[model samples]
Target: MRNRLVFSAFSAAAVLAVVWPFLFGGQLAWRDMLVLDYPQMTASNFGGGDLFARNAPQDGFLSIIAVVMPATWVVKALMVASAVGAATGAWWLSNKELLPTLSAIALAVANPFVIERLLQGHWSVVIAAWLLPLIAAAALNGRALLVWLLVFVASLTPTGALVGITVALVCMNKHRLVTLGLGVLYLLPWAIPGIIATFRGGQDMNPLAAAQAFAPRAEEAVGTLGALLGLGGIWNADAVPDSRHLGFALFGLGVFACVLLGIRSVPKRLIVLALVGMGIAIFAWLAPAAMAWALEHIPGAGLFRDSQKLLILALPAYVAAI
Candidate 1:
């Protein structure tokens, strides 16, 4: 009962965090929160367009459901359900350490970019973001069932879910392979659909074409060092020119802080989580080309476009850090 009450309080806080700004900014909506191009894809998909968000419209799983459901109230109901699930996941994964969990979620919430994502109806990001900690918890405990469940839901969003699940696994100790298997399992269902979507949408990243195009840009200052030092380059919400670019400076700082915290305070087992997270982080930061190479070579890998999504690798690192 105490736990339930505490969970309720924190959930309330999370919802308030998300809603307060909209209210303050005078953008509160009685119908929905599709603030920008969000409603475009939602509206279009409802009208039977599979060409939804070809240029990446925040990966609209929640919105897609809103379109599919018959009842008007179901959309709002599901939105609340997703938000509650995310909050519950956050609470369960916090290790009874309220401050850090609240801080982390709060940081994510207070972030102008994140707020903008909410306003723009990027419910998928918010939904995936809320699930990061729970996924980490599942990974740490070697909860195969939980891990796969997350992976399956995650694959639907492809990019963010992969990012979150990858980060969570990197933070685990006992079930790295198990988590990988789960990720693969979850992604398998979407393989055909994603491939079809890519071709139909013409958004597939042509590695050969990208490499050829790369000849002139001189890499455009995308080094991991520059990214890390720049606070994961998050200050520029438009930093990577797309939502797929998860390399925000705030995320970097969060991971860095996690590393320092692990070194100072966390247990050995938990430190293992941090170490794995840092390993993936360093790999992404240090040898980005190699990272890209691996992603390209790996099946279902092309679904993730930006190297910055590697920031999802830092979620567990934050868990260990805090």
Candidate 2:
């Protein structure tokens, strides 16, 4: 009980340290994150026309909560809540020693992946990330309902859903059919509507063009490999920290090496998961022609255009191994 209280205090402090300004200062909005005093849900938010349902349930969800609180506060609350929630999840994953627990908390809530996405205003993805480790733990315990419930929350965005499903498959290989069914059901809100919109009203964001435009990029001279090694290769250069271009960017390579060496009783499937994630993260950049071809030929492939989110698949491995 004492340790739990200590962790809770530490986690809250950690979250407030990073996001206190956004909560108390001027309106906190950036990139895709828009803030309005009152956000209303409309027909378009459901799906159809030139728009994809990427922000489907997210916008609708906020609209519902905004009825009781301001949208700015809603978003701020989300950031703080998700970060602290992630730390709690990390505590469960760690060895439960003080030092290891704190280290896992730091890596889970304050790492480059969280930073880049937070700076990019991807609160939805951040929420999914907080749920990642929890989902895996539930799966290992054979908690089917918990797994599906977590995946449903994560699926508010397509990328979040994909990584959640990938983790689910890795952890719960027993009930493949049931897992797949629940996954499809969770994704139906965005996936089905997205396909319908593409066929009927044309695309607002062209997948082939988006594939080329949003390919993984380098932070500096070390190139995309360096950026991704640090778990911070967001296509939007402005979303990344300026320090990412510095000489220390290669520091993550050390973490990667340590993680590989540290693997012991962790599932071998986690390594495969990490490799598959890296492959997807680099796919568009390394094979532009193939990426373009798939984007053109495959329906609803736009979801993969911003491929970096797939890196979340590797995160569980990193957490468990380290």
Candidate 3:
């Protein structure tokens, strides 16, 4: 009962964190939500359009829901659900005593990566991020089939798919070949479109220039560094709320102290995840030259135009590791 209460509190907090900013006017006038997609989605032949033809299947699925329900309600529900789901998933994955689980849940659901994504109105990525912990839990339990299905759902977004693959690779220690095969099979729907798009070659930008453009700013480097410790980092100045820098600093300090006190208890994989996430972020932000070289020479490195998306994977890993 106590555990349940703790989980409930964390879930409520998570939902509120995401929804609080929009509660004032109860408006659904945000970025993609206010676009023509809402009307297009409400139409019976929503998915038949070219806009959705190349889009992730998840978009179509959401459109179907919108067709029957109020669009505003659907969008609001999903936003809240994403936060609660993330908190719940993190709580389950922690598998620790109350204090650690609570800490992990707080860090996981309230971080900068999530806040930034929410602000950007990337619902698919948000949903995928929320599902990651559940998928990881399934993988750790050797529920190979369940993990594959969850990964398939997550793969509807490219970033989510990448994180799914990482989690599967990390957790599916047994029957590795079978897990790999399942992953390939489930990812085909999303992968096929991306593959075709890549070959079709749209507007090509200088890889280094793209990286430098999207990389975290130097002034916000502290937040990005704090993100390595499970705080938030939002690169866009307009998107950041007041006092966020101070919040990031406090969160980072708290996490640092926790790590120092519980270093031995931390999972090795989490340390590895932090290093990998930080390395990718730093390379894109500070070493754009090398990233550009990779983009120029490597066939698919350009997929990571916004290399900061790698932090999505790191956030969940940070929670589970805690």
Candidate 4:
């Protein structure tokens, strides 16, 4: 109970730390502010139809949700409930370690830069963040059908694809066929339409080119020093995003400490996954040169253009490793 209280308090504090600044419509740093935008300008119509030119799934799942029950209070209640689902999922997956569990709770609460983005209107990302751990728990428990149902529901939203794919890969089940079939089932609705539209030249983008885009080259890779501090350091710092990178480092350190102390032995496979994921995050956050090299040599380096996605991969990597 004491631990739970600590968890709740930290979760609420971290969330408020990220969220309170914007509650009054006050300006956020560029990246936090950008969350207000991003997916809208992405390569696909998966964000939405070509309906408004703003036609992207920025709020895909949320829009459908609002339509079903348009009241603000109702939506907030439902979203909060979903956030609880996400927290529960994290708890189940974390091997019952106090610090790791606390970290996961903190991540879930402040995640995707807190529920602020959702409150501000980017419901798709919020939904995806909320679903991420839940789906991972289902996969870890070998509940293929449950995972499938989640994927299907999440697929109706925008960022869900990313979260679903991350969980699938990290869980790395031997029953790949089950996960694949379920994924295809969930995605087929959007996939079929997207493909048809492409063939008819009505699709939203050039998939080939879209797949090739890299991280914005000009954005400097900030290090962990400023991250240790609450604000971004002097050099071209993007505060929240930079601070998040710090959070990732702390997460990595926590795992390393666990491993070093022989708290328990971890399997080799999970260790490999965690190390690789952490390496990727470090490369992206500390070495601009390495990040560039990756962008050139690796196809999906750009997919995680926003280093924030590293947490998506990192959390499961840690959970599995633990």
Candidate 2 structure quality by residue, lDDT tens digits, 1-322: 8877777788777777666767774565678877675777676666644666778767766677778877777777766766766676677667777766776677777777878887898878877887787777677667778788878778867787878887887788578688898888877777777778776766454656777788887876567876776676888888887777665567667666666666774567777887898888887788877877887788767677778877777776677666
- Predicted model with the maximum lDDT: 2
lDDT of each model, Cα atoms only? 0.48, 0.74, 0.63, 0.48
Cα-based TM-score, every candidate: 0.57, 0.88, 0.79, 0.57
How would you encode candidate 1's per-residue C-alpha lDDT over 119-207 as one tens digit per residue?
44544555565556567667666676776676555454556556655655665666677677767655543444556655576445666
Q: Compared to the true structure, candidate 1 yields what TM-score?
A: 0.57
Candidate 4 Cα RMSD after full superposition onto the native fold (Å): 7.3
Clashing pairs in 1: 231-249, 232-248, 232-249, 233-249, 234-248, 234-249, 258-321
lDDT of 1 at 43: 39
Off by over 4 Å in 1: 1-11, 19-90, 93-101, 104-122, 139-148, 160-185, 194-255, 263-301
Report the Cα lDDT for residue 109, model 3: 71
- lDDT of residue 31 for candidate 1: 23
Residues 145-228 of candidate 4 have per-residue lDDT tens digits of: 767766655564424665575466556576677777767666554555444544454424333333223222122242453221
Q: Tell me the number of clashing residue pairs for each predicted model.
A: 7, 0, 1, 5
lDDT of 3 at 64: 64
TM-score of 3: 0.79
Measured with C-alpha atoms, the lDDT of residue 8 in candidate 3 is 83
Q: Which stretches of model 2 miss by more than 4 angstroms?
A: 1-6, 25-28, 67-74, 173-178, 204-209
